[model samples]
Target: MRVFGMQHIGFTVPHLEEAVRFFEAAFGAVTCLETGRIEADDAFMQRRLGVPAGCRIENIKVLRIGNGTNLELFQYSGEEDGEEPLKRNSQSGGFHLAFEVDDCHSAADRLRQAGVDVLEGPTFVDAGAMQGLTWLYLRAPWGQFLELVSMNGALGYERAGGPKQWSPVTGE
Candidate 1:
């Protein structure tokens, strides 16, 4: 089976307010949803995912980071049991998540000025079709690796620089 597209990327945070504020300052994302109960909304996810009963799930905020893509943040009550956020090489294997930006340099500057750790970049990625593309990596306040790509390139299920072409196969 072929996968369609990414629905959303989820992150578990200790505090919702702080995470929300950081994202707002860094990416200009606005709060789209704030819910307290995961179980009430989806009992299957709650039960199957091992989300404890009565867990204080707050501020399931969705930010429109790119075209038809969203960044979903979840703030669970109490301390985080997982590895510390922002430690790129920590026990948590997941390295980073990227967002498309109009201008990577400006975005990096904004993030740096806002006290977010600008790890690297605003550098070029020579991906053949698109040269001189700029991108940078930053550590979100919650320690998640956020990549800002500054290039006018199409992504996901669509070809870069032009319309997509589909091919059909014949059954023998």
Candidate 2:
């Protein structure tokens, strides 16, 4: 058997509407699908997703960024307070999502003009395999760290001896 590319990545959010707006405004994400809810139980969730014993989420939503990856936003409550927004991508199980943009600098500038917090950005890499890459890291309204990256042209490794680079971007 073989595993192919990723379909989507899921993220838990405190507010569904807010997240929807963020996705729409930030990445021009389109709403693909939404669901009602699932019963709160250990067996049901555990068997499917191993989601502890309790915690049945409501208002599950899915957003797609152009033709790239999809973001699955699930609105869940009652797990605990303060955990609504995660901080520091340093913990053991922490992770960040990244999206490939056509022009990294322009994208970052647009984001800044939109009043979004662009933490670090427009960093150019010119030494390694990422030679022609430009990237920026920004925080979502809910504090999730996401990145905008691009290598509009061929990288150093690709020019030298690396395999062909694949892009999720649609339309040349």
Give the candidate number with the greatest lDDT.
2
Model 1 lDDT tens row, 65-93? 43545678887653446664355555557
Cα lDDT listed for each candidate: 0.65, 0.82
lDDT of 2: 0.82
Candidate 2 residue lDDT tens string, 19-69: 899889988988989997866577877788766666678779889897766
C-alpha RMSD by candidate, in order? 7.2, 2.2
Off-target runs (Cα >4 Å) in candidate 2 are 83-87, 170-172
Residue 52, model 2: Cα distance from true site in angstroms: 3.9
Clashes of 1: 2
Steric clash pairs (candidate 1): 85-143, 86-143
